[model samples]
Target: MSSLPLTRVDFDAAATRISGKVRRTPTLEAVACKSDPAPGARLLLKLENLQPTGSFKVRGATNTVMSLSDEEKARGLITASGGNHGLGVAFGASMSGCPAVIYLPESTPSSKAAKLQEWGAEVIVHGAVWDDANEAALARAEAEGLTYIHPFADPRVVAGQGTIALEMLEDNPEIDTLVVAIGGGGLIAGVATAAKLRNPDIRIIGVEPIGAPTHHAARAAGHLVTLEKIETAAGTLAPRTSAELNFGLISAHVDELVLVSDPEMKTAAEWLWTEAGVAAELSGAAALAAIRSGGAAVEAGSCVGVIVCGAGTDGIG
Candidate 1:
């Protein structure tokens, strides 16, 4: 499928494709804790952190890798990522029995690199940031004639990520809003499309780190724009620019955009650990941060769904 406008049907088909290949991560009512909700507010957390790779990136990576032709698979898989996506590729390749090479920024956490190696990936540490590593991966893919899996820009990846929405709506049809963290916008794009298709009135709120507000910047400019620099601890959410297709999807389906500070995310992560016993990374905690920090306002008693998308960090404490 092209990066055309996705519908609920696409998400449904993706759910079918990824069934059993990925975990059907759970959704639970937010536990009462330090990050307690506003009076009458109800919070539902989608725990994608439980995925085998400790992140939602596996859903898309597995779908993309499994969809490859036998010949393409033989050529091997190659991709670039900050941390979680690389781990997703490594895990997906292991499942598919394909040789894989993962390019990562030098700044990537040691724990993530160790995980990639544990999954048997040829880990190449290059560049100082994700964009730099991404450029290297692209050139290497062309030079080596390898199949490249984009972290978030490809349609297949987006469709795979959309499966989360299908499961969410299935488990809780009454959800009135979905709060999701945005990086390259793949997850939010796919989710917004599916959630809106399921219920046209369902609000899709996209959250980004204030330091890496690619989606917010793009929205403000009315087009895709690159940031001069990024400085967020949420490495997974630090893309220089949003993809064009993702921008289109966001413009068409996402209802609002909010930005949260790095410290807010840390507090949210700590709250998840202390209150809910969930080990969330900074990126994973962004949606909840948006809510707790009042960056994304919700009416009291509204059924709010927040995606805790990853847990690949060393520790939340």
Candidate 2:
């Protein structure tokens, strides 16, 4: 798993390596709701929000951190994230017996920061935004000879995320469309790669907040384009730009990208909690919001899958 596009074979290897260690989160058919789809039109939820670190990021972080060589492992690991990614690194490093250092934006929720510290990672409060925190983490990793475990932008992480789609497809072969939330685009990249490999016809739709539409902007420019400013309640999806690797994968595999409002995500989060007893943060619920807003309409009988990706929330009990 070098620095190349993640494929199904890499996903298979990752799935084998991390099998029992990670949860095979369940997929549930959507029940009729007052604000969701009309009766007789079904939806499916892949409940990755229920994962141990309360997010799908654990799958990628665990895979990437565990893939480190013994020498790399001995050197320790460093990462930067807004919240959920930091938790994943902290949790994964603990399992692999590696010392972890996490850098987070000043705006990171205290609930998420506390969770990372509780998982035994050294938490550094740095910069006002993610990019600034990332720069600090990179400098520290280089100065301290630590292995940098990126939240995204690495092949191993992408492969690990792709495995989620493989699991979901295995559970529900009839699935024709997948709605996924995009931040740095690792989750969607991996998932789109795997979904296309298994079923090229499956529609891969990426949901982004209107305020932070990295993919949409990049696609329009026909290259990875950085946004001037970030503004979103979906903090996990606030990356200023998609990486070149993620852009390539998304350009090649993802079928569509849609934008949703913060209010729409809030409604979806509340609905999921009330209807399914699932606790989802704004980023995790954005995918379902896309579908409900008719951004991802499907045939009547077709199964459409949405990833409830993460839940590192102050609201989670």
Candidate 3:
């Protein structure tokens, strides 16, 4: 990590490396509705939900898993996720016939655990938040010599996530402002790093749930900080603390962070479903929530990109 600078994240290499291993998910323009919040703003949706695991985390997990040595794969893969990354790691390991153990928080939806199980990964419902599950996962990895993949901290994972930036920018170079949701900060970290490096003039806006403003608080304190408890229904976005790697990249590359409420996300999700038929999870609709709720002060008439990052029936339900 010390050797790698923010400018040299190598998103292109990650794109080519993970080429056929993952889908080059398509992007589409969000046609305006009569009730549009930001009228005249050109909104483009990078539908990462179309990915095999129904989240962008697969890009990072597949890149990391494919980079592992055969001997390391034999030792098995271990990681903790609120939900999405677990599915990613499980799917990635399955391609190699490697065993994987996924540690998920109690907050994770049962549907996610069932999906992970479908990939042949052992699912352990651990503590209440991502940090608690992560602690247990790290302990088990250390105890059994398993290869642990850090969701946000690893350079490989960050680089993989950066590939989304490459694809989106290439697909539409006019995109001036990119709005992304923040969880442990991996997605935004990678997106900001790649987008800023690729086009220094591009603005990056990060969104988080108001209930779990981990990176927002970290940015406020100008250093890492942990929360007392989690409260957001966007479980994937409720990590109490942000990783140092993600914090550094986000602090360096992201322009500003906005916060949205759970209700706002639900509303945005409902809007997406009604308007575009995008059945996104609460965390996945966070970027749209920020824009729709005017939390992100995006300039009107400017082209903007938002990633609908995960899939679920929650909003529709």
Best by the lDDT measure: 3
lDDT digits (tens) for residues 158-250 of candidate 3: 888988999999999999999999999889888888888789999999999999999999999999999998888999999999877898888
Clashing pairs in 3: none
Per-residue CA lDDT of candidate 1, range 201-267, in tens? 9999999999999999999989899999998878889989878789998899898999999999998
Estimate candidate 3's RMSD in Å.
1.6
As for TM-score, the candidate ahead, 1 or 3, is 3
List ranges where model 1 is wrong by over 4 Å.
Answer: 1-3, 312-315
User: How would you order the candidates by TM-score, starting with the best?
Assistant: 3, 1, 2
lDDT of 2 by residue, 1-317 (tens): 12445667799999997798889999987785566552445688999988888899988998997788999988999999988888888888898898999999887888889988888899998987788899999999999999998888988989989999999999998888899999999999999999889998888999999999999999988998888888887778898876888888889999899999988788778778878888899898899888777776666767788899987343232
Candidate 2 lDDT for residue 223: 92
Candidate 1 has what TM-score?
0.97
Worst ten-residue run, lDDT, model 2? 32-41
lDDT (C-alpha) at residue 49 in model 2: 89
lDDT of each: 0.88, 0.86, 0.90
In candidate 3, stretches whose alpha carbon ends up further than 4 angstroms from where it belongs are: 1-9
